[model samples]
Target: MGKKIILLLTVGVLAAYYVYTPLPDNIEEPWKLTWMIAVSKTVAYLNLFSEFLGANRFVNIAALSKRQEVPPTSDENVTVTDTTFNNIPVRVYVPKRKSVALRRGLFFIHGGGWSSGSFALYPHDFLSRKTAERLDAVVVSASYRKAPKHLFPTQFEDVYNSLKWFLRQDILENYGVDPKRVGVSGSSSGGNLAAAVTQQLTEDPSVKIKLKTQALIYPILQILDMNTPSYRENSHFPTLRKSEVAKGWYDYFTTDRSLENAILLGQLVPAESSHLFKFVNWSSLLPEKFKKGHIYKKPIHGSSDVAKRFPGILDVRAAPLLADDARLRGLPRTYVVTCQYDVLRDDGIMYVTRLQDAGVEVTHNHVDDGYHGAFFLLDLKISHRIINHYIDWLKENL
Candidate 1:
């Protein structure tokens, strides 16, 4: 019995090593290798232990189950009104709570890589309520129609019109929110919208709604180049891979039916203009410190058919980082959060540098060990550490 037990233990140890070890071992970058190993260990542990204890599997199933649950307090004391902006549908979130005085107001846009996301997907809807309770603020979370259906300028127009509606309604007087303290915020694609809205507001002479602050969390500020160091390093990272990033742009410009398999073969952007756009100069504006772990290379040009199919991608609104220095200078007080492991980290860093160079007041937060979409996953207990950091920053800044 003792001999049999020893043999079994040896076999188990060997199995564990094999499961955790990643093949190929050809990942050139040290950090990439380390990150891959860590992810491999995580997956190995989940696969090996999940069947026996089922803890990881159970948690995943529970999360899916939770996504189906109607948000308990979303409708209570909160009024959701449907309206049309530039022929696009939008839903606004307004708190019904009584206030002692005027409050701060937030114009929020949802994130889905500019392709998919709704106001309901925000975990902070409850937190937005708490913000209303604490800061005496009126949070307007807008549900703008997404891409492929609405196209590029349509979403931007919808958001702009939503802001116009807020101003038209005299939200400050009715909701007891201070017009001077109005702000805009969002994560990922929504962050891009927030930045764009802030820029457009600054440019518009007719619109008197001035944004006091802007919050951008891991935003995709540019769309020109995909060959940044972060992209090469985190190309295979799950959830938001390089291919998926390209696919997002494809889906945004063309409808779902237009997404043929050939497009995925790098047939989206034209070859001549592929290198003509200023993606790296604008998007790769990362601080020298952020690039210590990787090397920079000139981006390889894309095929001619690729560019011809997606010409609208070169627009400044689609790639806000490409906006000139004059526009960057006109932006409001900005707050940017970046994650070390995210492909979009450099984009945020570059925007901060541009804003600072333009003399815009900027508050920057770098999450060293955090990954993309970490803060949005706060409802999950596994991501609590990163979530706490985000909440702490919001408390101090917002």
Candidate 2:
């Protein structure tokens, strides 16, 4: 009888903890969503064990799981090499089959919210290899100096310097790459870097080897406002919770934790930038199909206080969404992909709108059933399809 009573107490405690433990805000869904929630919660709980090391160290440590050694190439179809260009480490993939003409080049940047990612990371390593064979292009998978240690523009500078080197006659000749057919592409924060690089190259008179196109897959383009439609709708979405978005930016851009609450409250930019809000404010920018009875709220009025603290947050390279119309004009053709269930969905949509407004040619792909970090789940059938579609668009444009 005593054993039975103990068993009942254990069951009650377990049920109560499962039911009441606060989860990062997420939509209550059935089976698949439940699984996603479970995975996200598990990561969060596991991360708590790293309290002794601090959250930043915890993030870096957790990221180690995503890193694993991958071969340079699968077979003779592609030849791969890991080398540093302008001191930035890169994974280069060259198709073994000789091309009738010089092959197109793809400069790829992997994404891990600007905090963690590498060629060793899955999907990145696999994606780079597959892109070389599928597109018959020389793929340069770039690895930049990571953040919270290296800091903001340092990551940008690494990619920019590598791009300049990649465009050199010696580099192109070695890879049999066509200078005019080069494309820059990246996923998530890497997408943000790709956009910034495109802007820098487009505006620089010294840059002669211009990109033919750029592909941004589920990029985070702005930190100015976090109350967009997607943010509200996907606040609790599994892979990248909306609540974590601004915090990620804070961790990446500044060590000042106090500014986090203000940024989260949408109080970074001054009230004068109100006119600029329309371009990125999702209720007006996102399609009616996405609205679906969703109500729009004006962002809380901002003081320039946080902006003063970290002024680089407002730079065009840091927040391409804030780039002037003139700056965005004459950009290379752009391909943007947004996942339906991703927190950054509106970010991609708003960017497309801004690109179109600036007279840039853009191809937009929306994955209705996709989730944030879905590409990481390459073992899943849907991920394969998403990747194929992305490659198909690249094939058509490049």
All candidates' TM-scores? 0.73, 0.89
Per-residue CA lDDT of model 2 for 213-302, tens digit only, reads: 999999999987887778878888767887678777887778878878876787777776676666567776777987777788776766
Q: Where is model 2 poorest over a 10-residue stretch in terms of lDDT?
A: 21-30
For model 1 the TM-score comes to 0.73
Q: Per-residue alpha-carbon lDDT of model 1 for 1-398, expressed as tens digits?
A: 99999999999998666545332233223344445556645754665577576564434433543474334244566665554434545444566777666667777777776756566544656545554545546777776766665687777777877876665446557666677778888888888888887788888888776888888888887666566667766777653667767766666677644544443343344565555344356335666776766666545455655545666666666667767788888787788888777778778888888889889999888877555766665434424554455445445555
> Which run of 10 residues does model 1 get worst, by summed lDDT?
21-30
Error of 2 at 378 (Å): 0.9
For candidate 1, give the lDDT of residue 65: 35
- RMSD in order of candidates: 7.5, 3.6
Top of the candidates by TM-score: 2
